[model samples]
Target: MSTPKPATEATIRANRAVRDALPFDDTTDIENADRGLIVRATGQILTDEGDVAWDFDRWSFLDGEAPDTVNPSLWRQSQLVSKAGIYQVADGIYQARGFDLSVQSYIRGEKGWIVVDPSISVEPTKRGYDLVCEHVEDLPVTAVIHTHSHIDHYGGVRALVTDEAVASGDVRIIAPVDFLEESVSENVMLGNAMARRKAYMYGEIVGYGPDRAVGAGLGQVTSAGTVTLIPPTDIISETGTELTVDGVRIVFQHTPGAEAPAELCFYLPDHKALCGAEIVTHTMHNLYTLRGAKIRDSLIWSKHLHEMLQLFGDAEVLFSSHHWPTWGNAELRDLIASQRDTYRYLHDETVRLANKGLTPVEIGEQVNLPDALAQKFSSRGYYGSTNHNVKSTYVYYLGWFDANPANLHPLEPTDSAPRYVEYMGGADAVLERARDDFEKGNYRWVAEVLNHVIFADPENTAARELQADTFEQLGYQAENGTWRNFYLTGAMELRDGIRKQHVLVTASADSVRAMSVSMFLDYIAMRLKAPEAVGLSAKFAVVLPDIDERYVLELGNGVLNHHPGTADDVEATLTFDRSVLDGVVLGTTDIAEAVERGDVSVEGDAHTVRSFVQLLEKFEFWFDIVTP
Candidate 1:
């Protein structure tokens, strides 16, 4: 048997040539108005894990357009994620960037640190803390302020402080009212599906390399670490709430519906410093995140930013969780105004195009960032592209329709995939043409063609490999971290196929221990198999031993409703502590085993509740995609 030829330099060079021929950035423009001063340029620091490479100069490209800047918003967002490590924005306030996605914290009372947002992960968060500790005297964390409910903004909480601090009342956790509920509901209820989509949306599936990763544009990538939920000791329930932590006075401005559902900004009267959280970041934030969520209100977002401008017009230092800090009143004001107006433009033009009877696609095409707004680095869409944001803005105001009756009923993906492939010609013919285009470095065309092939028959290795190669080239050429991750992740999926891994399958002892009785019932409600419950009627009363709260759950017509108080009649009454329920959710034990082990007690008709468990579906922890 003859062995296949090894991958030669010629083959490597051939791949290299394709990557080289593709359009990519060829210039560096770091000459921001506040360069080397307010936004210090310390170049780049390698991640401690050494899993990824960082390039600062290449990221701050603004002098050129087109491929050099994948999207203006993306470029500006990358600036925040990849900016310098540390700088003194005010006398007592400091920001540590590049330590991980714009981690900014406030130094208070000589020995205590009041952290605003810790980076994206524990490692980088610790790295940032070390950097801060090196410059100033290391301080114990007296308080933590979570500005919003995004993973990157608060994922590093464990690194900054511990629950011991909270228990001892040495440290206080503060967040906007409803922040905890919103965060828990969003992350936990849909964690499995959201995690899968996030693997694509954030490019976590792809390896970090020149052709595989730049970052997710928000940050390099979220680090895998402990996720702890410490309840807020104090919630910012109202706008303009005044509070002081460790001798640092803060005036809070609640900006709901601007970014996260419950988000706020705070200004320090003494230092004249401001923390925008994710609300008014350096780049255009998502009107709709790719992973999935309710569409954000851009109109409300813009109005809130405008309010911030008036509220903190005299703020000397402005910092945020996802980007570098801006110092000086004039520069800070300009940054705020530019971001505020950009959202306004996106919202107004989208509505304007919609009023003209333009479809979503047409509306997106008709809208463009005004030159002035486009030129400003802060207004660019490093994380959120203009095209997507335009469509998102329309979607926010108008529902998912163009008022075109033709689109009223559309073919689903499975029905359309094979038809598209057949119309374009058979697999062999399409593959030959795509391979030729790949050789010609027309990756965009190659990708477009292979998409049909894969959708039609995802198991075709030849088609998958060809498409993977094309996506790799695009990933390599992409300047935006999010774009790079998108392309690279697509390539990885094409090559290795999708993996059905659930990160939340194994719950942390802390997250489980911290789980509340109400929260447990909510989790079970989310697990209800809607289809199975359809046309079925059942009622069960559940009792928590410690809390002494009686709850009734009604399942009928594919809906599960929970009542805090007792119901008139329940078919079965089940009694168990919260820990036993956590074990069930974590898949550590069967319902019967818990009952057998005396961990749970059944009262009344136990068989009815047991029968309900049969209706519940257990999702697979892993699935074989490539073989399938």
Candidate 2:
């Protein structure tokens, strides 16, 4: 494998100019980040197996100024989130930062502590909780509040509270309505595909270094540990719902569809601290996350910010799930309003441009942030940039269509590439021309033209090498961390190909068990091979005796449909535990073994059962990307 290249002179010039463009001399964010005195981790956070879960020591290179290879603005943002310790945001509120992508907060109640949004995994949150006990107070947790449905906010729940504790009413698990459905079903439904995309989005394999992995705009990195989830006991549905748990008066503002599908914000009346719940972070949050999930509602997100200010404008301190807290009412409100207006601007301008017959890509190129917003460090595109957000906003209203006949119904890349290459004087001519463009600091165009040759003939080693080099330079110049990660990771893959070891863990036993029977069936139906199942007709009456529910699975004309209640004249009647099907999907328990052991009992047409199983496709987890 070839070594990574140094930043080109063009990249160096671009990075140098970032210092002058942004107010790097101002130390307000630096001052605010280091406001509270606390002990940094300064060592490895090791699990029981002596394996390191999080290593601040590895990322210690972030302690100083930005290098020429990195975007100065992003480096500054990374430094703020890289600080690890227990910080006292207010009198009774404390936060554990830098353990993972998301931070966990501890609110001291009259009885014990109420933990908010634990980090992504067990070891990190456990480390965070231990820090709370050692540094803040040694109090048993009274409650665990999940501010949103994202796993990063609530996945490490078992670390703070157990099932017995929650069951016995010793601890209360609180969250927004439909939290379980949102967190488990949606994430697990597309687990494999999203896991692959996640690798590129975060550049997880592209670990910490001076030239790489400088924080993802949200935080330093995600933790590699066990992810677990527990259902919520208390659900907040409507806005302005007040709950006094252990003598702490908290007002919950339900912000569904703002960031995550199910999310909420809470304000402490006594402490005057408002938890934004990933709604407003230190940087511009993603309206359209590159991991290929649903598009977030920027209008609703801005409205929620407006509502937060109206409800908690007097908040002395404002903290979010990611990044550090903002102190003082003025500063906190300004941050909220700035982020709010940023989205509003994206929404309004995109729609305005579309009405004038402009498309998403065209509008994206034209939209510009006002000097006031562009100058603010918080409003910079360290995570979410105006360019992509404009496209997201336009698609939110007008969809992906650009209204041009040439754009609509275009040929797929694979089919069109050879034709494009032929028209451009073949592979050699394109590569020769692209090399000249690359030398001229025109990497964007070089990458575009070189891709046609790669797609036309993937065996073209010359094309792959040039494209990889182009992608590396683009990554070096990117200010947005996700964009940089995607570019750099793609470049690495082009050079060395995909390595399967770093796959993200998207589903677990806890999350799978939380899914409804219907939700699981829905995913199974999606996995049916339409080509294999064409002209096939079968029906299975699935009786889950443990859950005491009956479901009908009907297959016809290449479509698998699930219906509730009994179906007349079914091909076979099957009775088994839901666990059996889950095991089959997760590759834990074989269908044949379950049948042999009498775990699954078939009433009639056993041959149909075998045939139906054959039709269900096992998804390929390591499907190709950056290639056909």
Q: Best candidate, TM-score-wise?
A: 2
lDDT of 2 at 467: 93
Q: Give the Cα error of residue 366 in candidate 1, in Å.
A: 3.0
Evaluate residue 580 in candidate 1 and report its C-alpha lDDT on the 0 to 100 scale. 82
* Per-model TM against the reference: 0.83, 0.98
lDDT of each residue in 236-339, candidate 1, tens digit only: 97878999888878899998887789888899889888888887765677788776777888889989889998887999878877656677789889888888
Clashing pairs in 2: none
**Pairs of residues clashing in candidate 1:** 72-380, 72-381, 73-380, 73-381, 73-382, 74-381, 74-382, 74-383, 75-382, 80-323
Q: Write down the lDDT of every candidate, Cα atoms only.
A: 0.68, 0.86
Score candidate 1 by lDDT: 0.68
Q: Give per-residue lDDT, candidate 2, residue 388.
A: 89
**Candidate 1, poorest ten consecutive residues by summed lDDT:** 1-10
Error of 1 at 10 (Å): 21
